[model samples]
Target: MNTNSTEYRLEGDGASIQSLPKISLHDHLDGGLRPQTLIELADEQGLEVPAADADGLAAWFTEQSNSGSLVEYLKTFDLTTAVMQTRAGLARIAREFVHDLAADGVIYGEIRWAPEQHLARGLTLDEAVEAVQEGLEQGADDVRHQGGGIRTGQLITAMRHADRGLEIAELAVRHRDRGVVGFDIAGAEAGFPASRHRTAFDYLASQFMPVTVHAGEADGLESIRSALFDGRALRLGHGVRIAEDLLIERQDDENTYVSLGPVAQWVRDREIALETSPSSNLQTGAITAWGDELVDHPFDLLYQLGFRVTVNTDNRLQSGTSLTRELALLSDAFGYDLDDLETFQLNAAAAAFLPLDDRDELAELIQDGFDEA
Candidate 1:
């Protein structure tokens, strides 16, 4: 058995999970900033920070996010976004985000951030998107120079409660060939259903743009229904709450009898990916329907039922987690082995917004990496 970091090693062989190839589909840009970088940027921008130092600020973020309310969890982003109003800050943050992902063994990642939220300091929507794209390219080049391989794409997000859905959707489409991979609607999931953004979804559908909606996280099954039927999302961000649609008739030591509702069955049979962020899900009360622990997450159930379940670090810093750490926690909670971990990576690769040929290449890469391990 070979072990470096015990927290990120396989239980069976003690192989480093951090060294395995992985894909990220639901990571947030502002939420994944390095603590030191956040402190520096906040100081440079002359903004008041919650804490004077990196460690303190990180602790504050974790505390604030543990309020068990999605609204409260989102409040921490104000500080992160406050420093990201300038192009330099956005580029620097984006570059560092890629570096962090590569260091965590993510071969491919889609970084999502709302462009509209960064326009306070006079950056136009197009400028914001371009700045992030430039930073992503620079970061990828930096990784290549360091003898590491990492590919990244931006998922331009629209704040769900805001009135700029169409504008943000257009922004994503406008930069499709640049660095943007797809479109998403984030922010509060309750009062603002995807129906409010129907026009934007219709436009994206017409343009053949792929979309993933933040549904079934803070809301219930109806929210997921709107995301699929109205937003036409190909994936569900933290859609862990779809388990609410499941009805368990009985369970025995060897077998369990269950029934799937229409929405759950549609998501399962259609193979729409569920981007489950276990720690963040627990912090934001997304899995309150089950229990207050990682073992209570519906991810294993979804996987066992053949749902395309993908693991993710929704907000790395807030959760104090990497993709490696998230996978490790799940493995510990569910007794998963290397093959289960590989399946999750392959599921993410298959659901990535990249083209068919690129996804096929990513799958081959993942398979080869796991074979090496």
Candidate 2:
């Protein structure tokens, strides 16, 4: 609805990718802060920052995230979360996050963050949730005033290395009627499989709360299996490493024959959506098993193999990307066109944690937007 032209466009026909209605399922609240906002928040908190100006701060985050170590990549969040310890900071960040997503043409988005990480200033978990919800509502209202529409929900995350899974799960369910839509477990995924939070997952299962797990990004198929079997994840967060299960038996000039292992078979057959973030995946080396380049990502392979694939910006600020930019990059790498982009949005809309009727409405909205484009 924002008619401003974006730098990202489809390569072949030059269609504006940014104007298309999109869904964001894997975006992190702490990782998507505006650089300028970070600078101001840090100044208010009397905290030291890596850069003096907004541009320098932005570059700093990008550089640190691309350091080829997940631990180093996660350190950037320390700066972000450092300034987000108060209600005003959290609400302002959430409000600005929604505004940025709306400007990028995100019609529906689910912002995920861990509340425990924001408790340093003595804010209760419920207060944190309420603050974010207030900001989201204010942001949505602002968009509506501008003659645009956007919807959002919070995905309360429990750090995988922490022991607050059950508490976070309960927190999410407690706010389900207010703003929270689902529960997720993020952080290190190798040794900290979803099984470590089995009690929380079991409780969420009993309550029928939708779940998504951050598996297959830093780990492999077994981790994904635990997310499915133990976490009962309805969707996977950056489940790109599931590509390991695809055995490429042979390849020709135009055709490639592949065998799907049980994990791959189950994921594809069951239509589990893979929240693939192209820029972030490359920066974090999540695609290293295939190659180091975007072209080496298994997105195209999975898309061709009938795997439910969706495009996302896992961390917009750290990756220096938007959903539009991610889609354009994928298009440049894999020669995708408007229809392919639309398919990714449709997949995301269908995979959203909303009711079936709401999902259908989202699908219709996406179709209409694509048709206009």
Candidate 3:
């Protein structure tokens, strides 16, 4: 791995988190741009950027996303999406995304983004997908040249408030044999639940497409219910609010008693992976019910209760973080050991929207990586 000591590291003494073979199941393609790349892309497109330099731009993204409201926080994506209106921009960013993940020792990753959002420069949905695919393949090559290996897939997302779910789902299935691996619906989660796009989900189901939904992040269990019932989401994007389903029964010297409501129970029984992004959850207030601190996050509770919790960096650039930094923060807050970290990686691998053979291969890779620790 690259010896950038300035890069993030875990707090544990066992091994560097950045060196472990991690898997990113819910990372956003638009949200993981390098600051300098953003500046150059914006300048080339004659678009306005908030900060004058890379450092300032990085700080600006983190600050903007730290706002409490999810809608307010989503405004940062407008900036990232601005310059990504062309094939070149998409390809370059995708290639660099793979390189960054490989540098952080992410052996497998699925980069999700809304194709409709990237069509502003007059490119069609297919064109946008093609550009991203080119970049993803190039990124794989780059990783090999750098003495590392990584496999990436694209998760095409439909904006929930928009009426293009069917189109995006079709687009996703159209490229299933290509780089696309799954489909999702993202956007405002309150009034526009997954139920609003039932036809799209139905169509994707008929096509046998794998799905993950961004639910319970900005909303509560009702939204999560819709994501489960309507969207048939196999995985939840930041389902941290499911903590609301837990009723603290009692606390003794030995352990704490908690009761899981039906929603939590169903999720646990179904073993639906919760794509929990610790830093982004804090910024978006997804874990506000527990508290504002990282330690206050119900990650430990959910983990202890046997929720298929997977650690992720939802937006690497906006959080100014990596998978390494995210795991480190969680460890520092919750006093997790290497075993906890390994479990998170294994959960992500099992929940990945890949073929059975590929999933098993990823599991093996993860086992080998963690065994080194």
Tell me the deviation in Å of residue 2 in model 2: 15
The per-residue C-alpha lDDT of model 1 at residue 37 equals: 92
Cα displacement (Å) at residue 210, model 1: 0.2
Q: lDDT of each prediction vs. the true structure? A: 0.92, 0.92, 0.91
Q: Provide the lowest-lDDT 10-residue window in model 3.
A: 1-10
Q: Model 1: per-residue lDDT, tens digit, 54-173?
A: 888888888888989899999999988998999999999999888888988999999999999999999999999989988899899999999999999999999999999999999899
lDDT of 1 at 1: 10
Q: Name the runs in model 1 displaced over 4 angstroms.
A: 1-7
Compute the lDDT of residue 341 as modeled in candidate 2: 95
User: What is the RMSD, in Å, between candidate 2 and the native fold over all Cα?
Assistant: 1.8
lDDT by residue for model 2 (1-373), tens:
1112458888777889988999999999998898899999999989999889988888888888997656677888988999989999999999989998999999999999999999999999999999999899999999999999999999999999999999999999999999999999999777999999999999999999999999898889999999999999889999999999999999999999999999999999999999888888888788988999999999999999999999999998899888888998899999999999999999999999999999999999999999999
Error of 3 at 180 (Å): 0.8
- TM per candidate comes to 0.98, 0.98, 0.97
Residues 30-134, candidate 3, lDDT per residue (tens digit)? Answer: 999999999999999999998889888988988899987788888899899998999999999999999888888899999999999998889999999999999
